[model samples]
Target: MATEGIEAVFLTTHNWGKAAKFFQALGYELDFETDHNSGQLRNGDGPYVFISEIPEDQETQTQIVLKVPDADAFRADSPVEVVTPFEDTHYGTKEMTVRDPDGRLWNLQAPGKN
Candidate 1:
């Protein structure tokens, strides 16, 4: 199956407060926040924006979430390196993570799996 579209943009930031403010100023409604360290924001439609604090000793990076029809099939046919195998998330979706040649992370998600 092919990717339906972008589901979300996961951002790793040094300052979660600053990042949250930035997205909020852009009219992204706050969906939820966790321990003041991470949050999910969305406009009206389309993909969401997820901001989180960078892990210690890890360089900040951005991740894109792609909505797919089937996470398992996508992983099986994908040519990229699989960083994480298909699994169910607490948020009710099946997801798999892959890394590009440049080491960029891409999360593939399929709805109603979990």
Candidate 2:
């Protein structure tokens, strides 16, 4: 199945406050913040940015989230290597992880089943 394109970008930062402020300065507005040091931001109609805080010892990284209309269908027809099966997320969505040819991990997100 073909992907619907990028849904969002997941980013990890050592300092949530500073990272959020940096994005804000870049014109991305905070959409909502979680109880944990994480939030979603957006600029225009483009894909949103989801940022989360990580321990200083851990290296921050960015991963692209691709949109799939149905995770089950995608799993059955996908050509890439599925690193992990789709699972329901606390934020309300079904997510699966895939590994690219370069060994980078990418996330596939689909609407939750009704």
Candidate 3:
């Protein structure tokens, strides 16, 4: 149930191209890109940066994605308040969200098989 460390930073932006360019200027290499203007970038061995186009109705926000050893076990043993139950993601990761005391949302993720 231990966390390895911060996995990625998820950013919702109105202009994905601009956001991606900004990160690229900062030396982030594009790892993957999708047709919807969503992609992942990496800088050397550091944590990844995931960028996605924000929906019209949603506000732009930044979310930190943490990598846990076992998301399922972490959720079951976590003392923090769960904001979302653990669920498998389309990217082949099991993820869940928990709210901090200050009401900040933290997303936890662990690698999973398809």
**Candidate 1: tens digits of C-alpha lDDT, residues 38-105:** 99999999899999898668899887899988765663655778888888887788888888799777
Model 3 Cα lDDT, one tens digit per residue, 3-110: 788999999999899999999999999999999989999999989999999777999999998888775576455588988888999879999888989989999998
TM-score, one value per model: 0.79, 0.92, 0.90
Greater TM-score among 1 and 3 belongs to 3
Query: How well does model 3 score by local distance difference test?
Result: 0.88
Error of 1 at 96 (Å): 1.1
Give the Cα-based TM-score of candidate 1 against the true structure.
0.79
lDDT of 1: 0.85
Q: Please write out the lDDT profile of model 2 over residues 9-60, one tens digit for every residue.
A: 9999998889999999999999999888999999999999999999989999
- Model 1, position 75, has a per-residue lDDT of 39
After superposition, the stretches of candidate 3 with alpha carbons farther than 4 Å from their true spots are 55-57, 75-77
Off by over 4 Å in 1: 55-57, 72-83, 99-104, 112-114
After the best TM-score superposition of candidate 3, give how far the Cα of residue 61 lies from its true spot, in angstroms: 0.4
* Top of the candidates by lDDT: 2
